[model samples]
Target: MKLWGGLSVLGLVYAALAFGIDQTFKWWMLHVFDIEARQPVALLPVFDLVLAWNKGVSYGWLSGDASQDLLIAMSLAIAAGLWIWLAKATHPMTAAAIGLIIGGALGNALDRAVYGAVADFFSFHIGSFSWYIFNLADVAIVAGVGLLVYESFTEGRAR
Candidate 1:
């Protein structure tokens, strides 16, 4: 079998889809919906639609007037590494997961390049307990990580 087992196309497709969906949502939110003006709109008892311009890393870490260019460069670097892994991926699940990550990373990097910060919207909370605001790209990245962890546990095990 080839290094990727001729399955790289699956990953490329997933990456494209994830990136498209993420950008579409962000464009609608920023342009049509203007989510910043309509802040804290409750979608559910435990969830809300809000605008959060993250100038930092995950959970608002490393925020300190860092240049957007720097952050975007970092994202691209990480995505390049993931792309290498995807090129060698043999399993469909692994390929998809890596694609999701790369797509999400590129989406966020684009946001930084255009908006000067990552656009976050979803908010989950319960009473006084609140989670960090995030966007669809964040969702894709998290889902990708979950898939990787699950694949790690399941793959190469005797069936």
Candidate 2:
């Protein structure tokens, strides 16, 4: 397939959408909603909105003051590599998946740059079990990765 054409444009649109939505959510939650003041608000029986600052990667791993700049740079670098990959993507799903990943990565990186940490708000729990607090960017990244994995498995077979 040709490189950097219609599919790539579609991917850029998806990326812009993801990034815009992620930033908008973060802005609303932090400013308009004042999530910290009215925090831990239950949205469902098993889910809620809460404010949490993650200085590191997923699940707050590798957290510390020094790692902040490192993480931001790493995220941008990965997003840039994915953008190149998106330019060559032949399938719509692949383009979208890469776009989502790129957008999410950049979104989280921007959070780190502006807030000194990633603003995670969504929380889920059941009984004694609890999941890590995360943001929309995390959701998009996970969904994109899931789509990519699914595409890889199904690629060998017919669509």
Models 1 onward score TM values of 0.93, 0.95
lDDT by residue for model 2 (1-159), tens = 344755888888888888999999999999999999998899999999999999989777889989999999899889878887888888999989988888899999999899899999989999989999988898889889999999999997875
Which candidate tops lDDT?
Answer: 2
Each prediction's number of clashing residue pairs: 0, 0
lDDT of each: 0.88, 0.90
lDDT of 1 by residue, 50-71 (tens): 9889988887886655667788
For candidate 1, list the clashing residue pairs, or say none.
Answer: none
RMSD of 2: 1.9
Error of 2 at 154 (Å): 1.5
Which regions of candidate 2 are displaced past 4 Å? 1-5
Model 1 C-alpha lDDT versus the unseen true structure:
0.88
